[model samples]
Each structure stands twice: as C-alpha cells, then as structure tokens.
Target chain A: MADITKSRTDTPTLWVERVHPAVWALGLVMLFMPAFANGFWLFQVFGWTFILGMIALSLMFLAGYGGMVSLIQMTVAALGGYGVAILGPSGVAQISLGLPWWLYVPLAIAIAALFATLVGALAVRTEGIYTIMITLAMASAFFYFTRQNYGIFNGYSGFNLVVPPQLFGVDWRQPVPFYYLTLGCAALAYAAVVYVARSPFGLALQGTRDNPRRMAALGFNVTAHRIAAYTFAGAIAAVGGILLVWQNAQIAPGTAGLPAVFDILVIAVVGGLRRPSGAFVGAFIYVLLRTFSPDVLTAFGLSNERFKMLIGFGFLAMVVFSPDGVLGLWDRWRARAGRRDPLTGKERG
Target chain B: MDGTNAMTSRLGAVSTGSALELRGVTKMFGALAAISDVTLTVRPGERRAVLGSNGAGKTTLFNCVTGDFLPTSGTIRLFGEDVTTFPAHERIRRGLRRTYQISLLFTGLSVADNVYLACRGVSRGRFSLLRPRRGDPLLTRSAELVEAVRLTAARDRLVSELSYGQQRQLEIALALAGAPRFILFDEPAAGLSPTERAELVAILTGLPSHIGFIIIEHDMDVALRVAESVTMMHNGRVFKEGTPAEIETDPEVQELYLGGGHG
Candidate 1:
C-alpha cells in the first residue's frame, strides 16, 4: 500500500529566507558607501574588504559545507593574481606577456580551478588534520618556488603596475568603479555559494561530509563530490585574487606566503564557517582592524606594528567567546527570540 | 569488455530478480579468515536470515556480499551478473542496497531529508544543479517511503533526536528508497525494546515478497520467526541451511549453534 501517513517539509523560519532584511540593509549600506567615503577609505577599506571577503568565502564553502579545511585558498588566489599580472602589462619587463585581458582572465580562473581539483583529489582521501597539512605544505612549497625562481615571479619585488583596464568608456581603476567591480564580484560569489548549497550536488557533498561511508553506500560518489566542491571554491578564489591584483597594482610571493594563507583562515573562522555571509562579516572586521588599529596604537604611544598583537587578541577572543564566529552568536540570539521547540541552535543555510 | 558484456546482459537468459549466489567466498584480514570459503545462494522472492553468534563472521559475510570489502577469493553474482570486484556504490546502483549493523545515517539532517536522499540515490538527476532539494521532482516518491516506514509524523525532526527504534526504521526506509530488488540488513533487530522488536518483525515479514532480503540478526527467536529459511554459521562457515521448521529441530544445528547457546 502507498503512504497513508501524513507527510511534511521542515520550513525554515521565513524571516531568515532569501530577500532577508539583513541582506537588504547590508546592500543599502554598500550602495551608499562610495558616495559617503573618501578615495582612501573606498579603495583601502571597502574594496579590500570585498576582495578578501570573496577569497575567505571560497575557503568557507569548502570548510563549512564540505567539512574540509584547506590552507591553500590564499595561495590559489595569488595564482590568479600572478596570471593577471603576467598575461598583461606589469612593472616587470618581458615577464608581462602583453596579452589581452579577455585571453588571460578565464585562463587564470581555469588554471586555479584545475589545480584545486587535483589537490582535492589527493586530499579528500585523508581526513581533518591530514588535509590541512597537505594544503599547507603545498601552499608553502608554492611560496618558496615563486621566491626562488625569480624569472617569472621577479624575485622578492614581484610584479607591479598590474592596473585595471579602462573599458566601455569608464576608467575602472578609479575609486568608484573599482569599488563597484569588487562589490559586484563579491555579490556574485556570495549568491553562487547560496544557490549551490541548495543544489542536488551541494546536498550530496554535505551528505558526504556528514557520513562518507553511508553516502557512498547510497550510490553517491563521495570523492567526486568533494573534488567538484573544491573546483567551484577555486573559481571563487580566483576571481577574488584577480580583484586583489587590480586593487593593489601588484602581486608577490609574500601574497601567497604563510601569513596571507593563515589570515584568510582566521577571517573565515571569526565570521562564521557555517554561513556564506559570515565570510564578508569576518573580512570586514579583519580589514577594519588592519586599517585602524595602527592609528589606535600610535595614539597610545605604542609602535603601529603592535597592531598585529591586537589582531591576534581579537582572533583569540572570537575563538573563545564564540567558537562559530559572529554569525553563530547572531544565530543563538535569533534562536532565543524565535522560541523554537528544540533550541539546538542554527541549522544554518 | 564493453559492448559484449552489455549485449550478453541484455540478450542472455539472465534473471532480473532478487537473486544472489556466492561461490567459495572468503575474506581475510591479514591471517584471520573473517569469512572462510563460504558458499550460499538465495532464490528470488525468498525470505532468508543468517544466524550466527558473536565473532562468527556473519557481519564479515554481509560486508563481502555488499562490496564493503573485497572477498579474498570468490565470485559474487547478483541477479546473474558477476560482481565480485564491484564497489559498494556500484553494487547499490545495480539494485542491491544494504543497511549497516550500527545504523549509519546523516544524523545532522532531518528525517525527511534522509528519505529524500534515498529517493535521489536511484534517480538520474542526483547530480543536477540549478534545482532545489526541497521540491525534488521525486518528492512524491520520497514521501511514500517515509509513509511506508511510518516516519511521516516525525519527518521534519532531526535524525539525532529519534529513538533507536525509529533510527532502525529510517534505515529500512533508506534501503527501500533505492527501489532495490535485494536488500541486506545487518543486525536489524539488535537494539530495540521487546515491543519494538515485535513491531519490526511484523514489518519485516509484512513487506512485499517481490523485494527479497537477507537479514543478519543474532536473535534466534526473532530471526527464525521472521525468516522462511535459515542459514546457521559457526566459526566463519555455514554449518547448516534449511527451512525454519527443519532448522528448529535439527540435532547438529542444536549441538553446534542453536542448542548450545541461542539455538
């Protein structure tokens, strides 16, 4: 006999759904920021935040939804930055290939994504710490390789003059256009992550994350799903990396080193590893501290470099007080307000 | 290796039914033979149970058949196709699905989602993007599985919140979701209250005969009652195979397995 029993779907609270008030509020602030903020603030603060946020969000997609922690995300982004610089005009002499932007941008993204798939193929077989270590090793190796090679990488000086091209009657390198460019890419990355999570493939990846053995038994290819997730994350980071080069007008081995790689991890963890929006929140906090902490320290007669200490303290405080980051704290507040029957807290989207 | 195998499978006198045959199946972890040169066959639409005590290699045999572990040396034919080296997922895609002894599930997900994934397991659009998981086209089919397992009331509840009995029921729903012709259930009635055990036995025996099953249960009373035929294993080998009435009265079966401890 067919199902005579009552059937139902668990509807997540409607307020938290798409077109959320919080998203609207954020969008409104971002839209007005270019008009309100000076050029220094626009390019250094907000544009940088959007770029780093996109890169961090790429890591979040893998770490949060797929249960994988990759330390190679920043390094992967640098690969895109290097591609953009090498394929176009740069401070380095002949290393810049002088190719058209169209020829190089997609090629850069494809290379990063392919590399991510290869890394995922090898790493997905191992769990937790092993995955992290492998990614770290690969990232470290790439950093060293770029530093020593010098021919393409231009040694410690790296590449400079990696400017944004003026296209469609607008100078994109200008503060307003650059801010819009970064904001648009970040929004696309954010929306893509949200949509993919609800897709069947994303669902299957989560299932694999929850229980690999069971997912495999259920006719899902666990390894393939993980690699696919990595590839998608790679594309996202590549976009962010290209944006970073345009914003800085430079790319270097330092951009792909241990410090940069760890910074992205800290950002993703402090925002909320479970939510796509958390990446932006974490990046905003990070960029604000890096930009303003020096002035705050100098006012207290401490050397501005002590700002690193403040950042470290901020990271510790976040980890200890809110293990899942700022978004997690927000989720708890919402749970209490919602008064759901079981307050196990935030089955986040 | 490609077309010939496909053509032979398509045109050959192969039985498209819940049938399985194991020839000299053996599984060794280093030197220990978990399942030692055991051979058995189940006819289509027959009710069967594997009876063995703790450490008797019953689970190992189940693992080998389900492709969780490759047999040391043997041939496994499911529905008349040789699949000795096939992986667990491949075996499942071929209509032989199974449930674990420990009741493995995506505990973080809701009960409805667990059933929904099972529906997707056998579907062609399992990897499709740009489609939401909530309105999965096969939602109607998933609902039926939830209802069949009598989990519709608690469908929206998180799986971690369910009682042990309910988790076992969800396990059955997962196995059934694939629309598998043959299902292997490992220790299905192991951890349940007496009433729950009775209800499970009733559910197991009540399932349609078209879907055959091999249940590995240690409870002799429950296993014998629900199964039409029985295979008793001792020290990793089949000691006896017979009808329930015949096994319940055999002297050797009693001395070796049923009588000595639970026989």
Candidate 2:
C-alpha cells in the first residue's frame, strides 16, 4: 500500500497523477464535445475557455512561481491583437506596409514580450501589494491608450481581421476544426508552462520567490530571472491573443479592457496558482459559469450584469477560505478520500 | 595583527591551503568604520572564530567575504582567485556558504523542504522540466544533512513550527546543502538555551574537516568550546589570535571584553 501510494504520488508529471479517474473521464468527454455541439456553442464556449486558459497559464507562471502577480497579461495580449490588426492586412487605414503571417506573428510576440519585460522591470522592483498595484496601473494605462488611440486602434470601434489562415485548405474556424485548434493551442501552452515551471530557470524563479536574498546569495540573479519569466509569460499570452482574435474574428479595445484583464486574474486564482493544471480547470469552470450564469440569474429575477457580484463574492470567498484556490480544495478532498496524493505532504523541504 | 603572524607560523594549519584570503580589507559606512584594514585567511578545514562585541565589525567582515557589500578598499580572494568584485551569488558558486545572524530558512516551506531548497544547485546551468526533483542527488545529501542535524523527526514540519534551536540547525543544514567548501556561521548560538547552545557547539565541532568554517560568535564559551583557534576582534581589527587558553589568558583580550583581568 505504501509502495502504491509512493508510485502514484511520485510520478514525474505535474498534478495529473493525483487526479481521480472520473475527472479524467469528464475532461475527455469535454474535449470531444465540439463533435456534437454546433459551431456557435463550440466557438462561444470551448474556444473562449481555451483562450482564457492560455492567458491564465501565463499569469500562473509569473505569479505562482515568479512571485509576480501581474495585472497586465491581458494588456500584453491586447498588444499582440493590435500588433496584427495595425500591422497585418486588417486596419482601416494601414499605418505601414502589412507584413506576412509568419513575420507578423513573430513580431507581435516580440513586441508583447518587450512590453511585458518593461512592466516586469518596474513591478519586479516592488514586492507584495506594490507589485499588484504597479502592474494594475500598467494594465489601466494600456486599456486607456487603446481606447483613446483612434488613429491606430479605431478608438472603441476595433477592426475585424480576416480569419486565421486555412490550414491545409481546411477552414480552421469551423466548429470541430476550431475547437481542435483552440485545444491544440491550449495544450501547447500548458505543456510549455509545465515545462518551464520544472526547468532550471523555473526552479531559480521559484527559489527567488521563496527567498530572493538567499537566491541572490546562491548566485542566482533574481531580477533577471523575473524579467525572463515575464518575457516568457508574455509570449504565451500573445499566443492566446492570436487565438482570441481568431475566435472572435475581431480585435476590440473592449476585449482588452479592465474586465478582461480582471477576468485573467480570476481564472488564475480560481484555478489555483500552484500548478499549470490549475489554468485549464479554472478556465473550464469559469467559462461554464460565464456561459450559463446569466440565464440562471435571470430565472431568479437578477440582472445579468449582477452576475459579477456572484463572481466577485465567489472570488473573495475562495481567497479568504482557500488561499490556494479551487485546486487546493480539491486536493484537500482527495487527501481525505485517499484516492489521490495530497500536495500538503512535507511541503518541499 | 597577531593572527596574521600566527597564520604563517602554524605549518599545515590547513591541508588544502587558503580558500579565501583577505588583505587590508576595510569597509566604512558613512562616517563609521565597520571594519578596519583587517586581513585574514580561511584555509580549507580550518575552523576559526572571530570573537567580538557588538559593533565590532564581525558581521561586516562576513558581508565583505560573502560580497554582500564591496569593501571600501582591499582585496578578497577565493581559492587564490581574486573575488573582491564578485557578487554574492558568484561568491556562493565559488563554494562559500553562510548562515545569517538571524536564522534564514524559507518559513513558508517545510523544514525538510527548506533544507532541500538550500541544497539545490541554483548556479548550475543544468535544469530539466521533465525530471522530478526526487531523482536529484542533492536531495539525498539534504536528507543526510537533515539527519545529521537530527531534524529528520520534524522533516515534514513547516519551518515556522520548529523550535528556535531546530531552526538554527536547519539554517546550518541549509548552508551545508550547497556542499560549499567553506561555511560561515554568524552567532549560531546567539539566542539558544544552554543545552541548545551546547548541542549547536557539538554540531559545529562534529562537522567534517574538509569544509573550512569561519565563525563569528558573541558567546565566548561557545566560540572557545568549538573553535580550534579564536581571534579576538577589537574596534574592527584583529587584536589577538591563539588557542582558546592563550586568548583566555591575554590581558588585552580580557580588558577588551570585560575591562578587567582574566577571572
């Protein structure tokens, strides 16, 4: 029994070894839903979840490991969306010559990374509450900049970019194809986040997070590691931005606004900040809530906008009650059930 | 000072020779001289102590050796390599590990986890995401260090839950985790009870001879008990260096510390 427990807990993967088989079955079922669901349901629900998950994964990498709770991940995603809209063949009045897909994608990623690096450069200098405030300030500034910049972003009225390129002559926007595309992007982002989280760089980042002075004494450059993490996270969020634009066939300042930015934080926190798996789980639950909550609220004679009250209250409750978030609660339940290995063991020393 | 002369006189005081050499090391913060032009050598396997009162620049000396602050003027070398300008991490990579005056374990983690973290090769370029940390060679080393410190009983306990002495033991274990060639202990017995202090002394004395140690201690008893040689520090300079008995009998050492003759 001890050997079995050790084998199950000691698996080299992330948190999957600890998950219940029923949860795995549910995930498998969800993955194949696009095959039966219509294009509207698939695109509006599953596609949005994937994009949100990818963005949350980026924030998870920075906040969970790097000790930086950045509020500008959505802002950087918007930069990527605008990068293509303004630089690709989409802007009403193109500022410069539009670039090819290959060039535009890489350029947008780089610009987004640079933008995140600058934000990290400032925010990394502060710790705890100050970091959150600084990043939030940056996010607010980005939101307003896109809102007021009529020449490029078209003010509040954003441009509708052409759909993503047909891969092998198959329209990727179709229900099944687009769902697969979103899944592919999300899985790739998840893999990358997990990979980076376990890498030497990730260990160093966590080490700095654990004890920056100790890490500094150990010869790790704390600030450089933080900036690198921010840049890496930005690149991931930019991928989500590309998917976001692809999903909606549009890029608006509103999508990159405060609500969207706060939504990224909500996804990360709701999922849990401790692991990359938290991103998908959090996004899945949040997307489910977003899609169905309005109807549920209306049935109860509450305004749809007031659904935010529920979300905000739920978020506060999670933080106040379970500081580690939903995954933490799940882990606690599994630990009690003896069906999964608990993350609470020995804590890492 | 006398320690400089004694270092040259004691043949084979260290087998691996000097890992760190300080020459005319001085540090001044604003108007106050925290450390005067004090010179010292830490030969491999040598267990030396710097005995000083408060504000005697013992901690300042450590800061300079660890590269926490660049010396106002002078040179520092590790393994005969100039490291005066090297940063703290660089110094650490070069095999210098130190414990602070205050215990500095990662309080958020378990005691075992804190030790494991310290043992991790932060400066090593090899990092793998696919591999679990269980296979790490350093983890076993950390386990061994934890066992050696008698912390295996509370290995799973959070660092915050440990007793004060246990935390100090963990701090030393953390310093040892990196497998540094030399370790610096700053007032390791500062707040410990008599029994706790004695246990810490035993731990320090039992350390393997391959690792050099420079201990800055306020408690003369603990310092003299574990240290092979004790150097008295007075006003930021080495006042005397001798066996514990010799230093104990020295009039200047007594006057510097207690303002009286040896008891």
Candidate 3:
C-alpha cells in the first residue's frame, strides 16, 4: 500500500501493492455505509457532504495548484444545476427542453465549464486579491442575473422537482442509492484531481503559480494554463452542482449567492488547501457542525439562529491556531509522536 | 524517433536566416533611458559577448531582446520574422531561450521536474492531463538534460536543496531545453567558484555549432574564452564591436573597462 505514494524515481512495483491499506478500508466503509446508517445520515448528512466537498475540491484545485483563490466555484455549480433544470425535463415545463438524461448531463457540465473558462480568461489577467475580487464580482453578477431574468434561468423561482433520471431500475433520489451515487462521483473527482496534479498540465500550472515569469520564459503560456485550470475545476464543480440539484430536487438564485460562494472558500481553507483530501475533510466537519450545532445551541439555552456564530468562531479558531486547518494539526501531532522514543517516552534526538 | 526527426526538420527549416537581429532598439523607463538605439545582430551559429560595467544597460538590452520589456522604439527579428511585439512566451516558442541573472527556479519542485517542465513547455500537449509513462520522450530528454548539466545525482531532490552552483547549472539546463536556435545567457558564471566557472565555460563552448548565443558576463576570462566576438556598451550605447583579441588589446577598452582590473 505504501508503494502508491512512492516517488517517481522509484522502481515500478506491483499494482496490487500500490494502494494504501487505509484507502481500501475507507472504500469498504463508504460502500457499506448504507447497510448500517439510516436514510437521514445517508441522504441529508453524507450526501450533502460529498456534494459540497466536490465543489470545495474544485476551489481547492484552483487555489492549491494554480494559486488563484477563485470564489466563483459555487456560482459555477449553480449554473450547472440550472443547465440540467432548463435543458432537461423539470417541473418548470415552460423552460425544460425534455432532453435525455445523457444529453443534459454533459451539456450542463460543458456549460458550467465554459462559464468558468470565460470567467478565468478575465480573472487570470489580475494577480492576488484582484483575482478574488473579480471572481466574487462575477459570482454576484450571476446570482443577480439568475434572480431577475425570467426567460432562460426561470427567474427567482428557479426550478423544483429536478430529480435525477431513473437509471438501472432504481430511484436514484432514494437515500441509499443517492449516497452511492454521490460517493462514486466524489471518489472519481478526487482521484482525477490527484492524478492530474502530476500531469504535464498540472505541473505547469503549479509552475505558473510559483513563478509566472519563469514559466513564460520557459515557453509556457501561463495565462492559457490558468484559464484551462479554471475550466477543469469548473467541470468538477458542475458535476457537484448537478448532484446538489438532484439531491434537493430544486435550486434557486440563493443556491449561488455571495454567502454560498464564500462558504466553499471557507470549507476548502478550513480543510487545508495543501492537499485534495483536505476539502472532503473540511466538508465532513462542516456538515457535522451544521447538522448538530443547532441542537447543541438549543440545549445550551442559546437560540438556534446563533449557529452561524458558533461556526464563525470555529473557523476563526482554526485560522488563528492552525492556518492549514485540521490536516496541519494532525501532521504536527504525527511528527511529534514520531520523534518520541516508543518505550522510554523520551525524545529520540 | 518521430520527435527527434521533427526537431531536426524544424531546425533545418530555420537554418537560413540570422539567429537574432535587433535594429535601433530603444527602451525607456519614464524619465530614464535604460537602453537607447542599441542595434545588434548575431548570425547563425555565432558566439558573441556583450561586455559592460554596471548601469551600462546590458541587462536591459537582454530584456528587450527577450521581450521581457517591449522596446519603446525599434524592430526585432528572429529567423527573419518580425517579433518586436511578441510576448515573452511567443518569442520563446520561436526558439529564443534565456537564463536569468538572479537564478529564477521552481524551488519546491524536484530538479528533474523543473527540467521536465521546460521540455514540456515547448512541446505539444502542454495541457495534457495524462502523466508521462516510463519511456516518455520528454522524461528521457529531461533526464538527459540533467545529466548534461551534471546534476543527475540530485535529480530527485527539491531544487531548494541544491547548492548555489547546482542551481545555476539547473538554470542553464532549462534554457537548453527544446530546439533552441538562440539563447541569451545573463551572467552564466556569476558568483561561481573557479571549478564551476570552468564547467560553465565548457557548457557554453561545447554547444552545437548551429546554436548561436549572446552571453552577458562580468568575468572577462569566461566571456573572452567562449565568445568569438564582443560588443562593448557604455551608458546605453554601443561602445565597440570586435573580436575578443581586439577588445582585449584595444587601448580605449583597456582604459575604460579592463583598466578597472576586471578578470
């Protein structure tokens, strides 16, 4: 299992020994989760976690690898959801084009990716805080346009009953089936990001991030690489968006509002932007907190509306204490434990 | 096999014209003229050196030629094609390569990764999502480049872990990537030990005959040893152009530049 993380210089090993044991264990647990957990846990908790994690993972791809902290990922996801709603059959008979599931799915992802690429074309020209401002501005524009325009977007009412197609003779909206669906998509998206991180495109994107001038001198179109990164990330976010709309069977302008956009950024940051897995970890933590915090707040004689305050404080604490988030804290603990003598309980060095 | 042939064909096709030609190139920084009316030309396979003291606009001249800064006035051509308005990467894709004076490198990446990126930059599939397999030509080329720069032992090490001289060697390896017809080396031997300086000179002089280059150096020993011709600059102007022997023996050059006891 450890061979999977081996450096590129290492000799090739057997494929069976490549993956880590922990990964196999996690896979088994996720696969069998429906057997033990109830519908609420599968549908409301894990389903939402996987969906939000996928969106946050897109932002992580852009921010971590490309050094562009874009806040438009949520909006891109919303647009994807809207694409499915408007292009395929939905409750909104006025707009639904009644396209087949296969057709609408790809079209939705493509539209979202194209939107991201266009936004990236505009955003990559600027540096640092300006990128955040530009992406946020675009996200705001998309939200308002969706809210006001009644034609293509269906206006503020958005769309409802936008369910996933019935494939394999199973109702995909069922909690168990939906869990597997979201889990499969999230795993694939995670693997794709991890695999692409080492590809030529990914390496060059990181190169541009570290030193754009040097990359340009080396004959790389830094701007093109960045724009392409946004497109890739957008596709991932769009997939998540489609799942989200199906999970709730609805979507609105509020789906991609400013707060939601910022939420994805917060999720990625709180998970640790250094690694792809961090987004999922952050999303899981956020889902748990958002689900259980209201109960805890009410138990403590505080209004459930103050759940936001608790989340804000938790985020602040994470940033102030461990800027890299939960992963950094885990890493520090592991490093400390590694340095201690096992039997003597003393420092090794 | 096919990649090598394509490179050869590209090289053969562009073999006719001058490697680099700049006419009346001038660059200004608001109220200051960094380089003014600097006209220079290097023929195919020519080895030339630009010698000047600090503030002589030598770096600025390299910047203009590399498209790091667009000249306020003048026309630049590479392989007989006008490229005065081309971006840095566009010029680079046209076979113009450059090494920085300040050691610009991807410190977090491995040495091989850095060279691999340089090779991948000019090649097709710059946006490939597929990782290179074991027998990938770019990987082979990158490994060969690392070996050429004598850093194969540190190939897997992070660039930040390399010694200063090793970093400079890596810089040269990057510029040598792809089918470069012309290279602008900005002080390739700067701050090197005598042994490293010898290595730098060997690398510069051992390049193929079809590849021309302009070297900017404060080390006269290095500059004169590798370069056949010399262009001296003073106060943003061309002071003299001659062979290394002529520049070494010219009375005015001795009085103005070498008299300062530069080696």
For chain B alone, what TM-score does every candidate structure achieve against the true structure? Answer: 0.90, 0.88, 0.94
Q: Distance (Å) between predicted and true CA of B215, model 1?
A: 0.2
Output the better candidate (2/3) by DockQ.
Answer: 3
lDDT of 3 by residue, A113-194 (tens): 9999999999999999999999999999999999999999888899998999999899999999999999999999999998
RMSD list, candidates in order = 4.9, 6.7, 2.1
Give each model's whole-structure lDDT: 0.84, 0.79, 0.91
Regions more than 4 Å wrong, model 3: A1-9, B1-16, B260-263
Clashing pairs in 3: B220-B263
Task: Output the TM-score of candidate 3.
Answer: 0.96
Lowest-lDDT window of 10 residues in candidate 3 chain A? Answer: A1-10
Q: Cα miss at B217, model 2 (Å)? A: 3.1
Considering the two chains of model 2, state its CAPRI-style docking category: acceptable
lDDT tens digits, residues B1-263, model 3?
Answer: 34535755675575546778889988999989998898888998899999988999999998888888999999998877788999998888878899999999988678888999999988888999998887788888998999999999998888899999999999999999987889999999999999999999999989999899999999989999999999999999999999999999999999998885654
Looking at candidate 2, what is the lDDT of residue B210?
79
Candidate 1 local lDDT, residue A231: 94
Q: iRMSD (Å) of candidate 2?
A: 5.0
Model 3 Cα shift for residue B211 (angstroms): 1.8
- DockQ of candidate 1? 0.47
Clashing pairs in 1: B258-B263, B259-B263
What's the TM-score of candidate 1 when only chain A is evaluated? 0.91
Strongest candidate by lDDT? 3
- The better-scoring model by TM-score among 2 and 3 is 3
